[model samples]
Target: MLKFTTNLILLFISVTAFAQDSLSVETAAIDTVQVQQASKDSTVYKQRYGLRVGIDLSKPLRSFLEEDYQGLELLADFRISHNVYIAGALGNEEKTTQEDNYNFTTSGSYLKVGLDWNTYENWYGMENIINLGFRVGASTFSQTLNAYQIYNTNQYWNEIQSGIMGEDMLGEYSGLNALWAEIVLGMKVELFRNVFMGASVRLNYLVNNTQAGNFPNLFIPGFNKVTDGSKFGVGYNYSISYLIPIFKGNKPQKLPSNNQQEQED
Candidate 1:
């Protein structure tokens, strides 16, 4: 009887220890799952959305350095989505060009509206962008024929001196305008918090314009130099900008793997 009682007591003790071990294992599993869920929730990132305003630094620098050029440009953009922005520029320019046969001045104000699609994939907390963009540009401008020498194909004949032109030909041609479109490729780097520096190269295609009767449109204000019988031009800008944060949105977070979670725990 004593031997039987001792065996029964040993079996009961073994069962109780097994039950305790099983309960402990279940509790540990529940704790681990909760930890992983909390970690994922905490890892979500927040992105800033805002309006950014800037100035084209190259224009003012050119105005100061070049005697025949004066220009100013203001730029702005608003974030509409991740990797996309609505952007535009407003500017005024006056340029004097001395050609082989003529000297002319172009003065005008232009407006460009566009969208920038950022192609760069940034790391966490970085807002730098490499973008491809397009613009529709319009300008209202005037051209003045300062001086011109009449063209003579024959070298044997003495050429008329430059700056000797009729009064009608030396006057300003007003009420002139042009329309153009451009493809822009550029980058913006964040130099400081909410401050960015950017540069872009533009390939412009002239769509339409009104030309002076006697003088052709050799140079346009916003579109730059116009080639004879060609509808293409080129431009560039360097800018500095400031951002005003308006709101924030959540960015998707990458979750850790099981091994990483275990290591973290």
Candidate 2:
């Protein structure tokens, strides 16, 4: 009887130990699955980086509407970092203006290079931007003096018409150039998968100008109108662009708090 009772006690102890070990293994497997699911749910978001190319639509509309104006501008930008872009424009313009005493035409090509800083924060899967930028512009151009009337201080000689100058004063002046800088404020909105529409206002300051000996540079291609004594000018453009994505990058992630991390664990 003593031997039988001792064997029964040993069997009971072994059964209990085996049951506890099996329960521990099942608990560990459940914890591992929970951890994997949590990691999958906390994946980081990705962003696109690429080059965007476009044309200034306002230039084409103006060329169609204005009889004395013709212009074409092509613009491009590339993303170099988060919220920063390298941008540029290349264009050509020809314009004719009739002043009180003179008439002339100016034709030229211009190039502008710049950088843009974006200020907007986008939601997931959106790439809109509000940006402030700066540019340096250079132009090469020529001027043609079509007609002019000499200034006459004597009103009494108006009957004689000595102020009227004929074709003798008509001439073409070449090899003129100019340099300027501008501040740009703009916004861009994504219209479709890879299409965007944008607009910008610019404030320009003329840095240097090369003029003909006999005539002055009244207007520049990219710089617009030149006031008599002012170095400042204003301009704007509307554009539609398409993005050619180059690569993808993970967006910056924020760290969790201690309590949140403990809960996740």
Candidate 3:
């Protein structure tokens, strides 16, 4: 009877120890799961920020195509307030035309300021984006109309080609300026974790018309001196850009205080 009682006591102790070990293992797994979830949340928040700096490519409208004109913009984006970025940009567009009658190139650079309103939040892979914006800026515009007629290799600008042949150009001039309004649509996609590719389109119209007769009778922004048998017009821009993230730092957030309280409960 004494031996049998001893065996029963040992079996009871074994069962209790096993139950305790199982409970400890379950608790450890629960703690591990919570840590992993918190880690994920921190990772997501790291991607959130209020500023982005980048560049832009602009292709002017039809009137700008015939000339060797393409524009590039340098930008600074600031988030003085949530979901809104106030920005400043400097840009340049170069136009070149060569023909039997005329050979010339005109390059333009301008300073710009604008506001961006971002309403898109859920679009994945679209951290670099073009919020709706309005831009008003001034550019010191200049052009050289060197030839009586420029050859149209692509047949893209027949009107300008014919004007050059007519020798309607009087001379080239500097000291022209114009104010412009831009409607821009732009976005960026990630090529790597910190590198992104971007593109934008803009509609640019000159607010002032100052014409130069001495230069070829080609249309140039802000240089519309007169409408004497020459046509002055607006332009469009198609641009591509790259965004590189600099100065990335790791910041870890502590778990919410309520979580510990709930786990204790």
C-alpha root-mean-square deviation, each candidate: 6.1, 7.5, 13.0
Tell me the tens digit of each residue's lDDT in model 3 across 199-243: 545555556545466453344432222244533333333333344
Q: Write the per-residue lDDT of candidate 2 for residues 164-225, one digit (tens) a residue.
A: 57677688999999999999999999999999999999999999999988678899999999
TM-score of model number 2: 0.79
Sorted on TM-score, best first, the list reads 1, 2, 3
Every model's TM-score: 0.80, 0.79, 0.51
Clashes in predicted model 3: 24
Against the true structure, whose TM-score is highest? 1
Best by the lDDT measure: 2
Q: Please identify which of the two predictions, 1 or 2, would achieve the higher lDDT against the true structure.
A: 2
Tens digits of per-residue lDDT, candidate 1, 40-98, equal 65566788899999999999999999999999999999999999999999999999999
